[model samples]
Target: MNELTPDVFDALIGQDFVVTNDDGAKITMSLTAVSRFETGAPATDIDGNPLRAVGFQLTLRGPAQPLLATQAYPVDIPGIGVHHLLMSAFEAGRTAVNYDIVFA
Candidate 1:
């Protein structure tokens, strides 16, 4: 299993990741974003509960269809646990659309 460790995150760069939406729709995209902060950093959630936050970006490559931010995407990553990504930002390249995602 490809565990969702920091090492795995490094290996995931430029690799394909399967993201499933609420309606169970799945799409394959490249993991193009680097983790901005180190893993296991202390943080607070909306409920003021303590937790760790991790960030990553997904790049929908060449001629890929646009994904609307109408809902959050539950990305399937081993050991990552229920990753729901909100479309944080939109970045358009010459051939790809990068979506900024923040998950805890």
Candidate 2:
């Protein structure tokens, strides 16, 4: 199981307000604006250099979509929690990009 420690969990929550569904699906509510502080350094290309433009993506394991805001999961899975999301960062006048997986 990919378990996230408290520190790691805190990092994502600090980045944005996350809304998740019972089926293990989640989305970053503040997607319109990236967090200047929580988001890490700029991303780099394959050559290991910095690049321009920065953003992140939220991912799910299954085909099932997330529940509506009004809906709720019937039960919470013990032990296994926190879904994975792709986080990307970049800067201008560069060719490198950085990416990471955040949990919610």
Candidate 3:
């Protein structure tokens, strides 16, 4: 569960996602979040078929609450500047789960 660098996440950035800075405030990406993104296609087994990897799409949801809530919201963090942004496959609900995003 290692933290990914901006370069790594930048590779995944495209036209499907957005990232904003907390007003240029420093922040760290949660390990759990990173882990989810790092999972990718598995190696080929003896069966001769490549293992299927978990697929996922990442959407930047913001206006984060002071505490965790059970519902989901689409908002931006007020006063935050542009830190980093990313978007995966826009074709339907497909996104690469093999990349992690790291922000500062």
Quickly count the clashes in candidate 3: 3
Superposition TM-score, candidate 2 onto the true structure? 0.20
Task: Write candidate 3's Cα lDDT for 25-81 as tens digits.
Answer: 332221122223434556655887654343333333222322222323222222332
Instruction: Kindly report which residue pairs in candidate 3 clash with one another.
Output: 17-87, 21-81, 23-80
Per-residue C-alpha lDDT of model 2 across residues 59-94, encoded as one tens digit per residue:
212212222332322222223444433333322223
Q: What is the TM-score of each candidate against the true structure?
A: 0.55, 0.20, 0.20
Model 1 alpha-carbon miss at residue 35, Å: 3.2
Total clashing pairs for each candidate: 0, 13, 3
Candidate 1 — which pairs collide? none
48 Cα displacement, candidate 1 (Å)? 11
Q: What is the lDDT, from 0 to 100, of the residue 14 in candidate 1?
A: 75
Q: Model 1, 9-54: lDDT tens per residue?
A: 6666776667775567776677775555545756876788766565
Q: With candidate 3 superimposed using the best TM-score fit, by how many Å does residue 104's alpha carbon deviate from the native?
A: 24
Ranking by lDDT: 1, 2, 3
